[model samples]
Target chain A: MEKRVTVLAGDGIGKEVTDAAVVVLEAVAKKYGHMFRFDHQLVGGAAVDAKNNPLPEETVASCEASDAILLGAVGGPKWDHNPPALRAEQGLLRLRKQFDLFANLRPVKAVSTLIQSSPLKEDIAKDVDMMIVRELTGGVYFGTPSLYNDEEAVDTMPYSRPEIERIVDKAFEIAMKRNKRITSVDKANVLATSRLWRQIVDEKKAQYPEVEVRHQLVDSVAMSIITSPKDFDVILTENMFGDILSDEASVITGSLGLLPSASIRSDGFGMYEPVHGTAPEIAGQNIANPAAAILSAAMMLTYSFDMLEEAQAIEDAVYGTFEDGYFTGDLTKDQPLGTKEWTEKVLQRLQA
Target chain B: MEKRVTVLAGDGIGKEVTDAAVVVLEAVAKKYGHMFRFDHQLVGGAAVDAKNNPLPEETVASCEASDAILLGAVGGPKWDHNPPALRAEQGLLRLRKQFDLFANLRPVKAVSTLIQSSPLKEDIAKDVDMMIVRELTGGVYFGTPSLYNDEEAVDTMPYSRPEIERIVDKAFEIAMKRNKRITSVDKANVLATSRLWRQIVDEKKAQYPEVEVRHQLVDSVAMSIITSPKDFDVILTENMFGDILSDEASVITGSLGLLPSASIRSDGFGMYEPVHGTAPEIAGQNIANPAAAILSAAMMLTYSFDMLEEAQAIEDAVYGTFEDGYFTGDLTKDQPLGTKEWTEKVLQRLQA
Candidate 1:
């Protein structure tokens, strides 16, 4: 099998991490007897500096020609003063819009080695492994007539049946691959959009009869996320609720630097990235954790290339490195490994 | 001093808990040398059973004539089959609408003795004494043209300057009373209403120069509530965000039975109630916890009547009772006190 991947090493620590992911992916390709071609593209702050555009046309063309895209991180304080269109983060947003990447998958799994660092008690955070499927493109953030003046402001939350159906279908498909349970979250009693969201979930469930479904109010789910996170399998929510909840779920793992996310469309085309952002202060230090970036490559393998075993191998190797007491600067104060050294350890474990 | 208190012991354990609160209020009245008159009224399922209305006209009249209202939990499975207007919870919603109770106050404090019961680790859960002031009457919950059909649904989130100003002022006032710091939560970068909300907070800061203020995104605040709850003093947000966050904050303490809430207008006229709902299964039993109802009365003393010292006395006594190992069934399983017995213990501590 062969795959062409676009590598967007945006700026700062993004360069370090994406370089690390490419090395890991090369090792995986060698071991699995697959042809993996990498196309490097400048984006975000780097693109803005060199080409005066946050998302350059050549970069988009390379991404359009690739099977999957792996991004490290985007934006920095240097570009913070730029106008909205020129902002570094706008590059990633535009890419998502261009690809119609409507479903965002954020998987929060409490690593046993990092459980003590979690804010939640060990007993509560120990077995929390859930996937949050968020509809990325629709809802309040993009709803029209969202205008404001000195006296008043109004933002709309709009959801059509087709939009709700596609996301719900994605959640159901993800649920079938995991624990076969989906918790559809919304404020059905109050918001018409939520009611429509719930209705779509109910209609879609008939198609996936083997997968169990439960409807929960957003508020109730928020409480349960902390108290009984183990009860959820796949949490499906609209844009705004998903934005809040996915972020909330990320913290329970304690190691933000170890989390990976994917934004994909129906055809399994995806852009994978680490949940952490660009660490400008630690950019060239060779000290930033690359676990999340490597795992994001793993997600790309599974979701975009349909290489489940290769994905699992990468995931296990990453976790095994932590289990073997290899620490990154973000996760420990004692004897931390450099980005290159940590990827080396993961590679040794992957080959072992 | 003289005061008229309207008590609505709506349904289930609402009757028992409200009865316990009355005993505590009577004791406080005697000790403080205040003339207190109590007017009892029906408002929820009980109102539906007796008067064929969830909120009877007479109940409204009684509430209007009173200086402040103390309500028990409302709603029960028995009324779940009723039409929307006839539902038991509608009574409470109508009351808030009737009084224009724009501000909903939910205070979350980690009690020392019960800290072990929290889902959060002891260090994270300890010192979590924050007040959440929510704008109740506006935002998406009650926005106009919240229409849904087979194809699409739309809900608006609208906030006028005056609406934001009043809620921000209330939050500032509450901040001045407590820690003199406020964390205003919004999604200003995306939502137009949130941008206006942030603007209002900035404008209102001039009037509250002594109170320190910080702006936070709603998603960041949600994570912070669990990661570093002690960092917040007053968390002010719009209706839907507040609903999700207050509920999230509630679970960290692990003692939902002890939490109290208040909905108030600008003039300090308010309705106080326990955050817990009507536990119909436990109704007419002596096992219900009345700590929340008793605390609601304390909130009434401070907010509605401006009896700060008297409010402190009630608060201290309740905590003192718990510290002395007098456990209610909700807080403990071994040798738990009955509803009446717990109230007696609180009363004994108050008198001491």
Candidate 2:
């Protein structure tokens, strides 16, 4: 099998981590006997410096022609004074809009080796492995008539049946692949959009009869996430609730630097990236952790390319490196491995 | 000094806890030499059973005539099947609407004696004594044109200058009384209402120059609540964000049975209640924990009556009872105190 991938190594540490992930991807391809073509494109601060546009036409064209896109990180203080349209984050947002990437999958699994670093008690954080499926493009964030003046301000939260249906369907599909349990979260009793959201989930439940489903209020789920995170499988929520919850879930493991995320459409076309951002201070230092970026490549392999076994192999190799007592600067104060050295450790395991 | 207090011992263990709180209030009044008048009113399922209305007209009248109101807990499974308007929770909502209780205050403090029960590590939960002030009557929860049909649903989040001003002022005033620091939370970068909310907080900051203020995005604040809860003094947010965050903050202490909340107007008139709900299974049993209800009375003394010293006295006594290794069934497994026994312990400390 052959697949063309777009690599948008945006800026700063983005290049270093993406390079590390590409090395891992190349190793995976060699071992699995697959042809993988890489197309590098400019985006974010780097694109703004070169083309004066954070998202250039050529970059979009390359991504549109690819099977999957893997982004490193975007933004730096140097471009902080730029207008909204010229900003680094706007590039990623526009790409999502362009591809209609409506579902954001953030899977937070507490690594056994890092359990002691978790804010939650070891007993509570030990077995917390859940996927948070966030509806990325709809709801309050993009709802129309978001206007404000000196006297008043208003933002709308609008959800149509089609929008809710697509995301709920994605959650159900993901649930079917994993634990077959879905916790649909909303404020159904208050907001009309949430009521519609809940209704759509109920309708979708009938189509996937084998998957167990339960509805929870946003507030109740917030408490439950901390009190009993092991109880959840796939947490499906609208844009704003998902935004807050996904971020909240990110911190429990205390391994923010090693979490990966994917924003994909229904057709499995996705842009994968590390949950961490550009570390401008550590740019080109060869010291930033590349585990998240490597894991993101693993996600793209599974979600976009349907190479589940290869993805599992890459994941096991990454975790095995940590289990073998290797450390990154972010994860430890003791002898830490450089970006290149850490990727070497993972590669050695994969090759062996 | 003289004050009239209205007590709404709603249902289930509500009567027992409120009765326990009333006993503490009586003891405080006797020690402080204050003339206190107590008036009992019916609400929730109790009101529904007696008057066929969850919030009876007479109950509202009594609350209006009182200087402050203390609610135990409301709603039980017996009323779970009732119509929407007749539900037990509606009574509490109507009461808030009737009194224009726009600011909901929930304070979470990790007690030294109970620190071991926190879900977070001891160091992270040790100094978590933050107050969350939520805007209750505005935002998406009660916004206009909240309509949904087969195709689409929409809910407006509108905030007027006056609405934001009052809540911000309340938060600032509370900050002045506490640690003199406030963290105003909003999603200013994306939502128009949040931008306006931030503007109002900034505008009000000049009026209270002694108070230190900072603006935080709602998502970031959610993560911070768990990662570094001790960093916050007062968290001010809109209705929905508050609902989710306040609940999230509640579980970190792992002492849900001992948290208190308040819904107040700008003029200081307020209704106090425990953060815990009506536990129908524990109803008519003398083993229910009354710590939260007792704490609500403490909040009433400080906020409604301006009896700060008297409030501190009650607080110290309650903590002292716990420090002495006494606890209700909810907090212990070894020879737990009954409701009356716990109240007696608190009373003993108050008298001492």
Candidate 3:
């Protein structure tokens, strides 16, 4: 199974880490009798510097032609002064917009072996595994009345019938694949957007009788995610709420560098990436973790294409690495590894 | 010092816990040589039962005449079917509006002993002593255009020049009183509400020359608070954002049962209460934890009456109890203390 992968090693440590992940992907391909082809494309600040376009047409074409796209980190202090349209982050936003990736799957699971490193007590974080299915491209972030006049400004939290219909349906469908429990998070008590969200969720509930649906306020859900992540299964919320909650959920897992997300469209074209930003200060140091990017490769294979066995192989390798206490600086303070060592360890585990 | 305290222990656990808190406060008064007088009023479902209004005129009058108000948790499942206007939460909102309580201060800190009970890893939870200074009266909750017009619905996230100014000022003032570091949490990258929030905070930064002001998106801050809670000092956000973030922050500290909040007006009047709601199931049972309600009594003494030493004494006593691992069921799985016993413990510690 030789896959044509477009790697957007965007900027800063993205180049180093993505390069490391590429090496691992090649090793996995060899170990499994598969073809893993790589096509590099410019994005983020690099794209801005090259073509004055953060997400150039060539990059989009490359992604469109490939089976899946893997992006390294985007944005940095260099593009801090750039206008919104030309900024490094615009590349990510544009890429997300271009794909129409409706559902963002962020799995927050405490690497059980590394639970001692978590800021939370061992009992609460131990054995905690949950996936946050956040609805992308809608709600407050894209809502209207997002108007600015001479003096006053407004940002509307709007949700159309179809928008709520698809996201909630996606969430329920995702929930069906998980613990069979779905916690629909919203601000229904205050925001009309949430009331619509809850209404749609209620309507969609009858279709998936096997899945349990419970509604909680965004605030309460945010607190619950931290207080007791073990109590939750799949947390489905709107765009902005998901943006906030997913990141918060990422923290308690004690593995920011190992987390991966898949933003896929209904028709299957998707962008996979690590959740962290470009740490320019760590660029060229070879100390940045590559596991998240590598895990993203696994997600791309599992989701964008149908290769569950390969995905499992990568995930198992990650678990094995954590079990051995071989980690990048971000994961462990004492047994830190450089990018090459971590990548080699994971690939070596894959072979074993 | 004789202090006039109004007790509005409205509905369910409110009655029992308030009774327990009253016993504790009285003990403190006798121990501290502070003369105190008490006034009782009906609100929430209790008020509807007595006067057909969630916040009756008599109750409002009683609260207004008192030096400071101490409230029990309000609302329960019995009132769940009531219209929004007749709900137990409305009485609390009414009190906020009646007293013009525009600022809400919630201190979120994980107890050294109770940290084991939290889902967060112990390292992240260790030094999370942060105060969330929220603008209580403004933002999406009470903003204009917050009504359902026909099948179409609307809610506003509105703020004015003075509204932002005052809240930012209050946050900075509180920062001066605490760690002298202030984080203004908003969504400037997306929402105009946050854009205005950032502008005001930027303008106010000059006034607080010594106060270090940092601006962060609400989503990132939410994640940071959980993953590295010790990094923050004071979090300042608008009404709805505050409501969400503060509640999220509270959970990091372990139990909502141990957290207290103060809602105050610029003029001086304050309404202090535990952040948790009425637990209808625990209403008749004597096992409800009274530490939060008791702590609310401490806040009432300091913030409302300018009795700082008294407040510190109450706080120290509460901490000493937790520091010794003397906790209620909410903190850990133990032979849980009943409400009466928990109240007695904190009051007894005040003497030591």
Candidate 4:
């Protein structure tokens, strides 16, 4: 089968990394005897400069038409001065809204070769691997009644039953794919939103008898992730909780550059991106790690196209690339390799 | 001068642990040559069993009359099924409202004796002695307009200028007391509540000229705390963020059973409590760790009454008790020290 992939080489190191990932993906397709058509698109700061719109209609159109969208990084100092509506981040946010990509799947796994890169004790970072399936679209971030008045301001955390049901179902389904334990993180002990969240999870638990659902207040879960991330398999949290927890999980693995995520909608449309932002300061220097972007390609193949074997091959190549102790500047362990060297190394591993 | 301390020894190991704290506090009074009188009050499930109300009118009156309040633990299976108004947790909630304790100071320190409890590698957990000065009263946790309409629900995160000002001011003040760096954690990129929180923090930062203030969105900070906790000195965040961050901070030490918190108001009144809950499963079994309760008393001495030396003494005693490779069943680290054994060891260290 032929897969139409839309590639958003966002800005700064984004273009470099995405280019690197595309080459790897192209190689994977040829090696696997599958056809993959790649469409390049503009987004974030790059799009802002080109068409005065971070997320132009053309980009969205291309993304919607494709089976999957692969993104590098977005936003830089150039777009920082832009208004929120026209900013590079807006492009990323708009895509999430347009695609109805409610579930954000961020997987943090420490490659054995890069275990020493982390500041954490080798014991903790060595065994640390978790999948944070965050609700991408709504919660306090996008809930209604969000207003700023003269004296007081209020942001509402509104959850429709359908919204809760869909996300919970997505989390449960994802949990089934990985380890069978699903830790549903919320603030049920205090917030009414949490009460509803817990209620829905309780209602949904019986449907997936194989997955053991543990309800933890968001705060406790946050601590648990840092203290005992090994105890968890799949963490399902609200938008804000997911955002915070996913980042925390990234740090545990010791490199924001190696982390990858998939923002997916129910119809299998997804935008794969690295969790890191565009580091414009290091852009031209070619010091940024491209592994996250490369790994995101792996996720895109698996989640968006259901190409498990191909995805695993990409993952294996990524690990294999670093097995001999080579990595980008962001790797920051004992010996740091430049971006070009790491990218070439990963590609070499793939060919081998 | 005389001090009136209201002691609410709620349930389970609460009474036993609080008793140990009471002994230490008495020792503190004697060492400091101060008059400290304790009026023990009922709360949590104990209050419901005795006066049929968690925060009884009489208890509230006594609490109102006290200089500061020391809580042991609240809630268990005993009051888990009770309505919100009658639940054991409600008692603590009511007290926070009554006292208007807007600043919840949770100090997370990896105790030298119990470093083995953390799931994180010792290197990562080593320098993680930071204070999470969370805005205890505002944001999504207590936001009104929170409702469950069977099919859907909404929770309002309302923050007034005063609420933001007080919490931010409190956080800065605490930062002045500890490290010179303050990381104000919020979701200013998204939430209006965070906008106000950031606005207030920006305003208040001007007054504390000596302290360096850094802003981090809630999501980023959540991940950062795990990956790079040592970099942070004072972390100031909103209620929901704090609730999660403080718990995450607790795990840096590897054991939630070893942390304690203080909820204080501007006028110097505060409630000291263990950051952990009443573990009813191990209640009356003499296996529960009394270390957290003891540490809370130490915090009460330092933060509440300015008895720094006495607080240091208690902390030293705790470190000494654990240093000898002796610990409670909850610690499960080096040696097997039951509740009584742990308490006795600390007492010996205190008297030494």
Docking class of 2: high
Q: For candidate 1, what is the DockQ? A: 0.92
True contacts kept of 1: 0.92
Model 4 spans > 4 angstroms off: A202-210, A284-288, A332-352, B83-86, B280-289, B320-329, B332-352
What are the runs in model 3 whose C-alpha is more than 4 Å off? A1-3, A23-37, A147-153, A329-338, B1-3, B23-35, B121-123, B144-154, B280-287, B321-352
TM-score for chain B considered on its own, for each of the candidates: 0.99, 0.99, 0.93, 0.94
Task: Give the per-residue Cα lDDT of candidate 4 at B246.
Answer: 77
What digit string (tens of lDDT, one per residue) describes model 1 on residues A139-187? 9999988999999999999999889888888899889878999999999
Output the lDDT of residue A172, model 1: 91
Worst 10 residues of 3 chain B by lDDT: B145-154
Judge candidate 3 at residue A73 and give its lDDT: 92
Winner on DockQ (1 vs 2): 2
Off by over 4 Å in 1: none
Rank list by DockQ: 2, 1, 4, 3
In model 3, what is the error at residue B271, expressed in angstroms?
1.3
- DockQ of all predictions against the true structure, Cα-based: 0.92, 0.95, 0.49, 0.68
Q: Candidate 1: lDDT over CA atoms?
A: 0.93
Lowest summed-lDDT stretch of 10 residues in model 2 chain A? A249-258
Per-candidate TM-score, chain A: 0.98, 0.99, 0.93, 0.94
